[model samples]
Target: MNLKFLYFVIFMLCLGQNLRAQYVEKEEEEKITTLYPEAVFDSIQAKKALALGKGKITGVAFTKTAPLAPRIYADNMKIMLFPVTPYFEAWYKLRNSKENLRKRRYVYMSDAAFRYRLEAISNSVGKFTFPDMKPGKYFLTGNMSWSSTGSYNEHTGTSYGSYGTQADHYEKRYYTQNHEERLEKFVEVKTDGEIVEVKLK
Candidate 1:
């Protein structure tokens, strides 16, 4: 019976090795992002780290069409929080600042990459909270868009009469265009119980 038990133990060890090999192959086949070719997805690490600490993130999401435009609150808007892993670090570098982000508006990540994220919705006043977060660096993102319509007066040439030239005049011109505001920020939680407040505009 001792010899039989030894053979069973060896078979189980071989089976475990086979399972580990399959898992590694599966991870190798996963899709990757071209923005940061050196980045490898680490969903397990992100999730584990995200669940280890006790923290919270509170912020308000607001935006404007232009410098002189009115402040628009992101009412009932969605907010995404991602751990600053390698994949997200690459993404953040691509649009690190407002100027860089505005210039490269089409940069995107791979859809199939492993992503560990949390979500929340802003209230009517654009206030949102992500509680029970771990101590680490994170990325906060929100988007607001709408179409604005307005009218203005423009000076045109003199109107022509039936047989003679008429007087000069101004015409009312209407304009409408789509406007989008993207808010991206990085926040850190230093302790287990900390709150990071941000104005996510």
Candidate 2:
């Protein structure tokens, strides 16, 4: 073969190999993001995995007003498992700030760090499970709200004086107070693969 043709063929082969390597690297990165989305935003979980271990956490959330009484099921409850990190602590503080109330209108909406935290919804029977969590301190929280309606009577009085005589008129108005009752709890998880029971009041 001519030297020119040989050089052209070698260049083509090298280009193909380079393209293949790029494709493989991209695929591996995408897979990691899919499995551990938080790794893209922060290295906390990755560092924890390297230092400690990973395991599963399962539990149930219920409400019990009276002791020894059958607990009320808290179905479809949202449970969050947040790693104990400075980022998480700051987020928690921001979440509870009155000045940021307008910004935090949606409880489900969160940043990448918070969103990647392990989360689960309780089943019909109030059972929830979070599997494959890195071994570390995790802040557990759950919230559930129900609609409530109540009625109250308001009284209004007016007085008038004319011709040295006083007269008063009174009125009563009935009002309905429609509000929501929210149940929430904050707990700490110290062990992995251990069941943590949370009671909401």
Candidate 3:
């Protein structure tokens, strides 16, 4: 083989490998993360919502992953109430979409933006409350998460007998899934003494 022709073939092969690697990396990134808008965390707005006032907020967090599956509760789970600032609002818009949320990556938030929020734990029935909340708009979030084993019966083959008699063979199979219910809601306190009722599911 001519030396120049052999060297040219090797260079083309290396270029092809580089392009393949870049394509794979881009695909993985698309599946893993998405760029989101940046917004400054507003301390004043968050502080107002965290203050004590006459307004009250109550809610329950529950989720039914499937029609046939059992309903799961956020029992003993920590819940948060945050002011609907620009940062959280952006996260909500992206997370609330079913197309974007289904078995996909979760939107990331700055630690500072996530900090300084009210928290409460849900009861056995997934009920929670935040008392003396300042009259303002806020976001209530929680997790109603659990996992369970699923199963199905599969037929391997049929066993034939004399006189047209036959028998069926079957086997049981099982699988497990993680049911992550990251729930959120928007609540507005209209009055100092008003009570806001909500279902966080």
Candidate 4:
């Protein structure tokens, strides 16, 4: 082949390769965009089921005094659902204290005491949801607290007889205050997939 013809063929081949690569990259990008839509759609359908009263609980948890407490949206604050039984109710009554039910640790107590639990974190607006729960009586609890600690040092100096001074001594004192609140209620779920509202006060 002549030099010009060979060069033209090589250029055409390079152009085809570039076009193929660009097409593949575009396909990959399109695929990524299309991915995960089904999951999102499924979640929307589940929420619709909740709206139709499909054994789901959804509501906002807030204090009665001020509905917009920062702790209401805190990540450590949680909404817990436990089956309502005599034993579970008694256990909740006994362990219900500021010290025991503070932040996320409130949900960490003896799980053996209850048959099972379903929990959800409060969103930025203090909204929580428990989807697809069984039809039965359930006990719900929500608690949150904020605490601050401070320390101070005290110095005491004494002078001995005639210009004699004793060494200086200091004592440190520390204090902490935990402001917390707890809300509890018993709810029943119907078999026909009913949405139940359990608001924490």
Please, what is the TM-score per model?
0.65, 0.45, 0.68, 0.45
lDDT of 3 at 13: 99
> Taking the tens digit of each residue's C-alpha lDDT, what string does model 1 give over 97-181?
5755555544455553435678899999899999998788988887876577999989887788888968888899999988787
Task: Tell me which residue pairs clash in candidate 4.
Answer: 53-193, 53-194, 53-195, 54-193, 54-194, 55-193
TM-score between model 4 and native: 0.45
Can you tell me which runs of candidate 2 are displaced by over 4 Å? 1-43, 46-56, 63-71, 97-110, 147-184
| lDDT for 37 (candidate 1) | 31
Tens digits of per-residue lDDT, candidate 4, 1-201, equal: 899999999999999888777444334432111111111123333233224235788877766435553433433578777765555545555455455345322322343433356678887667888887767777778776656578998886644656675667778989997768777777888775788886665
Candidate 4: C-alpha RMSD to true structure equals 21.4
Residue-pair clashes per candidate, as listed?
A: 0, 0, 0, 6
Give candidate 4 misplaced runs (Cα > 4 Å). 1-53, 66-76, 92-111, 146-178
Candidate 2 achieves a global lDDT of 0.58
Worst 10 residues of 3 by lDDT: 22-31
lDDT at residue 104 of model 2 (Cα atoms) = 41
Best-fitting candidate, scored by lDDT: 3
The lDDT ranking, best first, is 3, 1, 4, 2
Q: In candidate 3, what are the lDDT values of residues 92-194, reduced to their tens digit?
A: 7776668767758577667776787889999998989999887788988876677778999999999999889999999999999877778888899988899
Error of 3 at 37 (Å): 3.6
- Best by TM-score, which number? 3
